[model samples]
Target chain A: MVSQLTRNERQLALVILSALALCGLAMAAIGRDDLIGGHGAFILLASLGMGFVVTSGYYHAEPSDERLAHYYDDPSKVGIVLAMIWVVFGLFIGDWVAWLLVYPEMTFDGGWASFGRLRPIHTTAVIFGFGGNALIATSFHVLQRTSRARLPDQLSPWFVLLGYNLFCLLAVTGYSMGLTQSKEYAEPEWYADIWLVIVWVTYFVLYLRTLARRKEPHIYVANWYYMAFILVVAVLHIVNNLAVPVSIAHAKSYSLFSGVQDAMTQWWYGHNAVAFFLTAGFLGMMYYYLPKKAGRPIFSYRMSIISFWGITFMYMWAGSHHLHYTALPQWVQTLGVTFSVMLLVPSWASAGNALLTLNGAWHKVRDDATLRFMMVAAIFYGLSTFEGSFMAIRPVNALSHYTDWTVGHVHAGALGWVALITFGSFYSVVPWLWKRERMYSAKLVELHFWLALAGTIIYVFAMWNSGIIQGLMWRTYNDSGTLAYSFVDSLIAMRPYYIARAIGGLLFLIGAAVGFYNIWMTARGALEESPTNADRPAAVPVAARTIEAGE
Target chain B: MDIDHNIAVVVAKSFGLFYLIALSIGVLVYVYWPSNGKRFDDAAKNVIHDEDAPWH
Candidate 1:
């Protein structure tokens, strides 16, 4: 990847790494007695490691300027690999946590390996590591095509991708070390937050710079969603992370808000993280890859417009629903539920738009596992949004909050919608990026689709059953109004479901493993029939040529 | 309950109502505008072309 850069950009990479290395060294020195110090050392070592990598490849002949005619895709390629690695890491941790619930003695005497610490590791790795990387990679691919432009510069794209990974690395490692602000999604302490701010600003600027160079007259719908994801996430992160660190040497910080206000702020950030980061960004990927693979135009451009604005206007207000039945004031909770219910309109609009776009492509969806992955994803998106709005109602939340039902809902979206869409997009992209006619093994893709579908079904159903049973057991009354079951009774009843959930997660993990292998083999040209032609990009699509002529 | 707190809640609620109404109108106008059909259709058709190359 470094060899693709001009010599000057290579030097710029070295300089950037060196500068970060200095900052890391300063941190290591100042915080030597604290967790911050450990993270500092990790940063320093990692930067030095990347610098060595750059220098090792520094002597390669400079890439020719003719490369400017093509889109810059090296960063996207690297980002995809990193995303796959993180997906495996994250899913493995998640299944481990599931099994730990079934068998409580599995942790090695608790401490860093305890459920509390490991849970965040699982969340961060999958959400920020896997999901974030996939979004960044596909955004680059989608943005360039939709905008009809090359990225403004080669070096900044690398800086954004690598620098974002560094932040994810810091966050996961920080969590494992028992260092956190105890916030749900925004758990990373002050330094990691500051670093992310820098990386994200670069990403936003890079995206806009590319868009500014577009030959297309109208910006695409996918770009709109990607832009919202980038912009809204920045706002959410900065606002929720408003804190005063104890000192430069310490990893701890005090939030600016306290009590109910803090709770409100955190959920506001948390739920919108779900909205922009997970939904909007992946929606961007779906809007591009699904239509492309199906060989169809989006069903309704006007509906896309309405859904985009409706989602934008509605999701911010729905966050308060998470604080329902708490001390967040009754009106705020009511406001949240109202918007949460209304959010169904836009959410279903986007989902229906995706499915409707496949009107003429049902045959492909039936025969092609890649399109099936996206079809199932749109269905799951519709299902989960309906379930979410239902659960947001205060009376419903009363039964569902703090139960595995919420966990079930989340996994429905995560596994069924988010992971499925990502796999579909990756399958479509990997072959294209690697200049292959098709994947290394279509049978493996078929196997993966079934495995993913079955796993999601089994996992979600188990959680739902266990959750409702537990809820009813707690709320049940004996004669004369005494509680019927102890909490331990509920736990005992949940054991079988926990075991089932673990197995379901294991199947999902194996499917992801299969996907990564297929992707890797395709990249290696394992299935390429014509090696010489494989080196060239696909014969340009016919429609593209006609479109170019028209333009 | 304090009167001031109640008043504040009422004001916020009213503002939210107005904001929602305005947002609904704005989105509908953008989606249904007479002249936007052609541009949006062109974009929907052409957005994913030139997958491996730029439009030049």
Candidate 2:
């Protein structure tokens, strides 16, 4: 049975075994007296046991001869499953964090489970674990389909999938143990960051290698977006995470930048993390899935090209807006605001292009819950980008800064746009990957859609009200010119909203669970009846094809 | 000394501003160039054309 395993699978097994042995040695060296060290050791042992069980099962299974002739989708399959698990875990942690705000006693002695330690865990888990995995899965699916080429080799995809997840594991565990470089988004200390760099560079090379082997004469626009995401993120991660560790064995590290320079560098990384990680990569998913689901050509290919360049160029300059009212040069703030405002043009162009692609497909969107998800995602993309530009203006930033308003704004994008589009794409891709005849439950898909939409609306509006009131109270003055509201007054006011926010988060979590269940049942072939035309080629726009042939 | 500092700031800002402008315009020209229209159109249709069997 082991002999039947591919070279890639065998290599992965070796890597896991060596890692487990190293973890054993490290555990012995660190001593189990310290609580944090004990926890780390326990996690390592558990992971090692799980790896052995899963690998043994995988190695013993026979690869179907029929599947070998088809597209390479196993890595994508692994990614999708991991993504679902992480989304649930991330959302659950996020809800706990929200509840911790209203119920301060929830911390209960303030160790690993305290809000400060767990907050980064929630953010990193969702953004990197959930969103990152979805991007990788969908990018592989889109790249292979769009490029009309096989992935260069099977080994690299597995390497990227397993390697990247290992980095996430180290990051989450280290954070819980109080290991960090004190950066916002790039908080993972030097060693973890370096590990990610290696994984990401391999991903970049694999993408380029596959593109070079394309059967199509031209590289697709979606691949271009994914490429930008991969390339720019690598650059940002490396620069922002430059730090010196106290010792090779210790988790402590000091960043290269200090004081105001550190603040500037952190936000620069934070803002671009959103741009490339959240926006560009997801845009890649949108370009492929939205048009395919709609059964239409993209509204304007030229507009896509123009906006791609525009977004890539404009977003780099907008990070400084995050440092408004700080010691960072006023001129730098001005530049940030200017470019952020300019960003709306390209942002809206992509959004409008997507909506216009649905011109004749409104009926399909109505009938198909997945299309509805993508359509709403496109609308939210427009709304969020507009709101972002408006907030970046200095006066608005002054009002919105350090308030729940910014939190509301981030969720409006993250929850409303990113998660929805990902869910939509997952619905379309999962059935195709398993060669299933539609999903096990279409009704459940519709149910999940409303749950998600309602949850986001409730979450965003609550935060907005909380933020505005907070901002106003902080600035209000008495007739004698003294401040009117004490700091405690604002805190008191936020209590009700925090409760409301937690309820919103709970709803989103329930919706995500519904999605996971539906996909799971679909994969297990729980449907009563299979559709006859399940394997039919998706309809492509005739006009676009004719134009292409003529060219 | 103040005059020299002012000159330095002006030189840096102007150079940065003009460089961005030229880059943007260059991108616009390259995208819209007539010769590349066929390529762009074909690229757009890649997803549609390869819908049947992506691996093939």
Candidate 3:
């Protein structure tokens, strides 16, 4: 029995159980009264959960004998763990914030004051804490395999991991305590910003060093995407977050740009933060993992190059589209629209490449859960891109800009494209990382996929319908040219969508839980597999490498 | 239609052609570049002690 569990597995399972116990005890303690200062309590719990996962043995690899050691462990399990934690943390933060609103007397500044404090805490942890961790962990696995390079320095990998989580801590904690620059996406106060800058610089250097030491002659297409993401994001972060803190301890700061200039800068950073951080980085995952899962060579390497360059050039100019109809200069608005429309080709190219990679392996798409997740993601990527291009049109923007349609569009990208791809990548990765011959239950995985997919469709459709109705209502000219529907009526129409959205979220939560359990059990099964590619082996020399004849 | 429509159609067709040509060039280059059975004396000499070595 003892031989069945590795040193890492034993520790991880125990920590998770202990955290569960702590959460249960806290809930019991606050039985009659809501937890006082729920913000701090949830923060502490969420931080502890994240810290435990990061430091736990599962997050690490022992040195392998290869020149560049393989992961020799499953990163997919790490991603599943992180994603599950994100969902839990997100739900708790949302509920706790809502509760604070309902029972204002429960804490300082009551419910209304709590949102300004905790919303950033919730957003940062979910975006950077959860999504960022998935990106880094998956990136490390993909980069290593594609480049055929053993990771450069073990210490730097850990630095990237620990430094990122620490940065997340500083950002969220600062946000909760009323420390911010009030720049929507770049809200972290000066000290936290400094911490992130250090973390991100280390990431850039580490990524470059590994690529430099690659065993392969050509840098794989995925590496290019990831490198662009890391480099461009660093530029975006520094430029948008330019502010002087009142005092490091005081948590107050003012942005350098003011008035219309400031608004332009914020959206520039905000929209591209999605472009570089979320879209490009996750696209890197899709490119590598989808083909790898389908067990096929990439359909067209040439298309990949075109798409990469196309997306990069087009997306940067499209940020001004977010400020359409504002005083952002007419020429700038025109530029945004022009580039935004141009973005469709590259986005579709990437999606087409993925689907085509699975051309012969279409049977796997039906049978394998991981491929299903990836293929669904490709479909959603196509859908969301079409929606995004349409939204960027000036007349369409006039209707959808301030409505729930934008929210629906964003979630389609997040839930359908990003989350689905991340999920598929994890499912494929965890078993290999854990050294399991197969997943614990393919049936459960299929069930999870359907539930999550159904949830997403329901969520998106409800919001889309409501958004159009609201938009029409808001813009309608009556016989006398008065507005047809009151703003309150539009708000009332949104109630059904909100309820549907919540239900959809709950279904996703359930599906994620199922995935988490399946991964945990799979990890248990592979606990005894001896770590093979250790000793941090150097990458094999390229020319000396023998090519196997094609199948 | 109008002149603008004609221009748009022409531009689209040209770009589409360019994309295909680029892909074809890449494929041809990959195929023709020696992966085996090429031992030109100067190239063979450089293989042993090439200063611009691919990373070891």
TM-score of chain A of each: 0.95, 0.90, 0.81
For candidate 1, the per-residue lDDT at A292 reads 89
User: Which prediction has more favorable DockQ, 1 or 3?
Assistant: 1
| Candidate 2 lDDT tens digits, A24-125 | 557546745543355346547655765675566664545555544556777898899899999999999999999999988898786888988899999998
Sorted by DockQ, highest first, which candidate order results?
1, 2, 3
In CAPRI terms, model 3 is classed as incorrect
Recovered fraction of real interface contacts per model: 0.78, 0.69, 0.04
Model 1 bad stretches (over 4 Å): A528-551, B1-11
lDDT at A332 for candidate 3?
A: 71
- lDDT ranking from best to worst? 1, 2, 3
Query: Which candidate leads in DockQ?
Result: 1
Candidate 3 local lDDT, A450-535, one digit each (tens): 98898789879877997899898899888998888899888777777777776776677678778778877887883333334346
Compared with the true structure, what per-residue lDDT tens digits does model 1 show for residues A1-551?
77888899999999989988988998899999998888889899999999999999999998887887898888899999999999999999999999999999988995888999999999999999999999999999999988889998888988999999999999988888899999998999999999999999999999999999998879999999999999999999999999999998899999999999899999999999999999999999988999889988899989988889989879998899999878989988998999899999999999999999998889899989999999999999999999999999999999989889999999999999999999999999998898888989888899999999999999999999999998889899999899999999999999999999999999999999999999989889898344432466778889999999999
What residue pairs are clashing in model 2? Answer: none
In each prediction, how many residue pairs overlap at the backbone (N, C-alpha, C within less than 3 A)?
0, 0, 17
lDDT for residue A89 in candidate 2, whole number 0-100: 93
